[model samples]
Target: MAMQGTLLEFILGWLMIPWRIFVEIYRHAFPPANEAGEHEHEGMLDASSGDITIDKRELSHWTKLSQQWWDPEGDFALLHGFNHCRIPMILDAYSKYIAQKPLPDTNPLRGAKIIDVGCGAGFVSEPLREYGADITGVDMVPAVIELAKAHWNERHPTEIGPDYLCTSVEEISSQRPEEFDMVLCLEVLDHVANWKEFAAQSCRLLRPGGCAIFSTINRTLAALIIAIIGGEHLLRIVPMDTHHLRKFIKPSEVEYELNKHGLVQVNLTGCTPVDPWARRPRWSDVSYCGVTYAITAVKRA
Candidate 1:
């Protein structure tokens, strides 16, 4: 049996070679092309074609990893684990702001319109749809957007799937002002050159009473050590250069941006594992050790 299993593994490994070669050849031949083509937009921060705020290096890095975006056990494994703590916080903040108890597990977000900026391959968008939100996921990479659309079709080809667009928040907001009730622009702050201006666009995309939840590493000594040194350099949980130390936004900066955009900050939480030794899932944490944090803000009615 052991020999049989080893033989099977060997055969499978050999079988993957041609497919891998084919994929490489295809990617090189039909490369994702220009960064400008990655996003379709004409609005604030980028009022014309070829003017988006995305960091070219960052977009390229993400585009290179587009194939792994939906694989929970792949390059985004840590982020996949991080979402266990994040999703609940988003649900709780939205429920509390409306003076309602948590919605039931089944389709809790029914009848809500949601926008997820930088939603690469729909890991967040897919689950949110299960909870019943009409989700519109936007990203600025053609390869990434194509992967997301393919994932959705393979997973739910006929259902009312989330609308995934290859665009930026500025363009989307210009096209559909005051359309969404909630925006989940989580973990996307550190990748853009115009984060503040883009944040204001998130506010502009929401209805009067809508809310947005943003998450990213705080720009601090702690984050420099943990997020950059430990995670990126030593562990390589994400691609090298995927995060820039200087681009990490401070919590206060997030507050200022939200407030400046006519949105009031409501909740800020440090997310960490409840217990580490037991290989436990993460939980909401109040301590601001500065590795990763999230902010929830609301647009006043």
Candidate 2:
């Protein structure tokens, strides 16, 4: 068994697929930009209300797995199990600020508005809604958004869930600038070519004093060894090509990029693949290292 695992890891590690092909495919899906650099086409992929970034292979890839998104131990299990750490990290970040009313039992985040950027099948958005947040989830993939919307409504028809959109953060932020209390880009930064633009969009979407939280992989030798060779190849926790080495950003990189976009880092913490305390063995972090982490940044007033 050990030899098999090692062999599998060795074979898969060599599968370092290039990301540019995916980018070119997406570009072909839309019209060429004119001299002004504006997208000549806007409605492709059902993102009529928004424009798309250059790299969007992740969207097209994940859209195929929409049916398994909500399954706890399925293809998206890493994200499913991550709720334990993610919810706590987000709540802890918000708890520091002073507010007029006391936290409500039913919805601690009542009256607050949150935008879940790159929300896959409404995983983060639906749960946040129970906390009384007026949530809006945006993703570049129209098919995934439709699937997520249908699933959310069918499961929680009575509950106030997120308003899911088939759009990019860039488009939505432009439409309603400086309008959210919090913006979350969980497990998404590494998948897009427009990370810097995404950071800028977060700043535009946030109200004065509003915050943005991002969870993504760190660029390190250890990360490539463990996350790629071990997780994707050997253990098969996530899909192959789920992570792109070129897209991984360092921790300081995120701080610096967001800072340049007028957002200040409040807190950052490392995360493991699953929560350790869960009865089932899952992903969780032992300490704040330079691995995978969650970062909270507040937009300046």
Candidate 3:
């Protein structure tokens, strides 16, 4: 009976797939374009002015898997609202990183030239534009880029909507050098094999004294059990094997890499996502020792 029920559910889910795709496509496509007078073609900057180009791609299989309804681990329902339960965590970290500045606003990132490297659907970059920044968000997958652009254009249109790019880091770096004031590399290092190369290209994109922010889970027993096993296996919050211990980096290693490239660590903070099961955030959940961390570094003046 259980096996029969499972098959029935699968057939029902398959029937719903096309409707979901159509709804998703409609939501992504029509968000009401800005007034024609307000429309500014972002990528075509004159040589006299600094121009920033962007590259974007689709979300990874892990991300796509996480977006489906059947994937109870998926946050597609929550994330589409741009109010993922993690927003508060990200906002709190951004607040402290700026040192007493208002959360997400009143920061130098606003209206500044910014690059979101490995930006997986503009979770950080979209809100960063709330401060008026000329933002560009990039990723490795065109699908995720399309989703990010769709969200930005339709749902979260800011005073300055961010530019979306579908390309690799090397491609963007080769095209636009020393162009951004802030480069964001959030929650991406653990997924990247050539982290050192990614770091170098991030620093290269920033101007002198510019800042870059990066966040990722550290490799540790606690992380494996909590972030991977508990989150991925037990609760099904994040996609399985989406995080690998080998790719995680310690704070010291990150500092060393930045110093090697003339980028100095300016600030560091820890982040812990609120457990969906937990009704509210707790201090016990907060710790600097965990796998999740955020760091801000500046290019040497």
Candidate 4:
């Protein structure tokens, strides 16, 4: 009887395993409506060509990757994370840097020119306009640029249109070289296929003494587990392929590339992790915030 009971218990446990896995997947994929709905916005349409403009062949793959990284509600979530319900953390950091002193009379825009590369949804760039900065925001995705335009329009109803362009960094640099006082490529370097080349192109766009800020995940074991396994498979918080380990760059590696392109790192900061348990932001270094790293660099003369 003891042997028979043991066998039955083993069988029961084996049978329940699949159900447990299914339940876990369901919970992660579909969080409670109340929680998910909190991020939802009223119906907004893309003003740039109602249809997405990338080539059809590349559209599927780009869209798949984009669906993961480009959260339709990222602006809303970022506002909640950074203690400022108005702008993104990156922009908040820049604004804080500029607001340190009074703006110079000769130069407007907080005494600096700014360019926000990969300005997804204009979360970071829009705030700069209020400070009187000549900010230009660029992104490759038409759908995303459209969304950013719509958001910009809604926010600045009385102001002139945003200086937003849709193209790769290299393409833009080829057309207009040495133009910006400062360039921002936050959280976007890892997404591109050839970051070294892209970084070089980004450098060419900057004027002497101009600054370019960047943020991305560093390639490491912790990054892979948190960004891919936990973020995509477990949490279902971001679409799969949002972070490709092979494309991720280490801090030293980025510094080398920037140095090669005549840019030098001025500052570096570790970001606080996003708390899944609390469903909010928290100050931690456990790679819980998907191992993201932020860097500020200046162009060589």
Write model 1 residue lDDT over 1-301, tens digit each, in one string. Answer: 0011245545654455455445434543464444233343222134354335566666778888888877755677666666687777767876887436768767888888889998888878878887888899999899988998888789887887888999877788889988988888888987875687678777889898888899888877677666655454444455555665556778899999888878898888888756432222345566673878888888988
Preferred candidate (lDDT higher): 1 or 4: 1
User: Clashing residue pairs, candidate 1?
Assistant: none
Comparing 2 and 3 on TM-score, the stronger one? 2
Question: How many residue pairs clash (N, CA or C atoms closer than 3 angstroms) in each of the candidate models, in the order given?
Answer: 0, 6, 16, 1
* Candidate 4 stretches greater than 4 Å from native: 1-111, 274-290
Per-residue error for 54 in candidate 4, Å, reads 11
Clashing pairs in 2: 272-285, 273-283, 274-282, 274-283, 274-284, 275-283
TM-score of 2: 0.80
- Tens-place lDDT digits, model 2, residues 143-233: 7788888887898888667889887777788899988888898988877655776777867898888888988988776776666665666
Q: Which window of 10 residues has the lowest lDDT sum in candidate 3?
A: 49-58
> On a 0 to 100 scale, what is the lDDT of residue 104 in model 2?
57
lDDT of 3 by residue, 171-228 (tens): 7877887898777887777655456667787888887777777777776667766665
Ranking 1 against 4 by TM-score, winner: 1
Provide TM-scores for the models. Answer: 0.80, 0.80, 0.67, 0.67
Question: Best by lDDT, which number?
Answer: 1
lDDT of 4 by residue, 1-301 (tens): 0011245545654455455445544644564453243113111112143222222323344444443232434313422343232134334444445444544443246545677877765766776776667788888777777777777787777786558887767667778788887778776776654466667787888887777777788777677666656554554444434555655678888889888988888767666645544333443333233377767777777
Deviation from native of the Cα of residue 253 in model 1, angstroms: 0.9
